[model samples]
Target: MADIKAVLPGDVMDTGAAARDGAVLRLGPGLVQADERTSAAAAGVLHSDGDLWWVAGNRRRYVAAEGEPVVGVVVARHGEGYRVDIGSAHDALLPLLAFEGATKRNKPSLAIGTVVYGRVVVANSFMDPEIECYNSHTGKSEGYGELAGGFMFKCTLGLARRLIGSTAPVLAALGSELPFEIAIGVNGRVWVHAEGPEKTVLAANAIRNSEYLDAKQCRQMVKELLAR
Candidate 1:
């Protein structure tokens, strides 16, 4: 089982898991390194995944972090890039050449309010963040690009994280019932597409309601939804 404990601001964290020789520790949101020690920067539950540690709090506003996949809406076309609203304090810049194989002569023309899935390439507190529609290492699209013809909705950041996990019972339950395509962004946005609008709405609502449900409860909820 994973170690999960509630913590308050300024609480020192046990660094044993991150203290393995030659292992580098990665700190996530609400955690900070002060005086060469790790401590909580916000009141939340402490969670550790391998050498990465973070504090999960009830925060609706997003703080951009590099390499996190996000779903954003194009709000305006700026010079050489588009300003995207990624549920952050500031809009992120998506350069025209950020897409796979894009160049000066050939680039995507995105309209305002268009939805896109991209990864954070640069996130600095001093400047606005930047995003890209392709994998920098592999130079592949990797399913990062415009998200077209889907129903988008917002949920809590915690719920978004849960839906993105590999073992999300709600997703598993929904998958067993019908075919659907989903795009989840850590920024608390979810896009769902199914064979029909009704099915899409059903799947999205199931996901929203399953945030606090157990595995068995998820399955039962899906069954009840299908019966109605």
Candidate 2:
């Protein structure tokens, strides 16, 4: 046997992440690129257009080694469930039970733009990776949710990283204290939850402009309590 464990890339049509503009790359026969940068936790291989490039998909930001934790983004809210867009085409679902004291009715109260830092309960689900915010021993919000506030003023990915969990406080152009919560997914999807819609918009602007942010940036995000 030719070492069946060593799989090769399929045809271009067989690959799903072969996108243009650096979105994807075709490695070669039976091997396509699957990530642009490291820290993606997992990697993928495919054969698309006879080229190979790393495309980020459903890859965990941190490796899931039984007790390791990873962060993810929320893509959808299904009444009592949520679909997280953690670099995967198919968003993983966090059910009502995922939340503390959650019920069929109160389950729908959670916002969709929440980021969750959870322990990977079931890593290799058939279609997508599954997770549980609360462990079997206890129940909690899984160290995820509206952790901070502010909007992304800049559109670039670099600026987004600087703003996520940045201690920079947001003061409006008009001198109003901008109170907001910003959830930045590893995939560069920034979600903002502000006390006032206008404040949120300003924070987002500051986030976008993080590249040019001054020294007196918002250093204090909201009071945060999470596991290290």
Model 2: number of clashes?
Answer: 39
Per residue, candidate 1 scores C-alpha lDDT tens digits across 1-228 of 258899999999988755765568877778888788999988999987766677889887988877778999999997889999999999999999999999899999999999999999888779999999999789899989999997999999888877776657999999999999998988999988998898999999999999889999999999898888
Question: Mind sharing the TM-score for model 2?
Answer: 0.42
Clashing pairs for predicted structure model 1, backbone only:
none
Per-residue error for 224 in candidate 1, Å, reads 1.8
lDDT of 1: 0.89
Per-candidate Cα lDDT values, in order, are 0.89, 0.44
CA deviation > 4 Å runs, candidate 2: 1-82, 103-127, 132-138, 142-161, 164-177, 212-228
Residue by residue across 124-210, what tens digits does model 2's lDDT show?
425455655656456666445434444432243334333443433333321344445555543444566676766566556555554
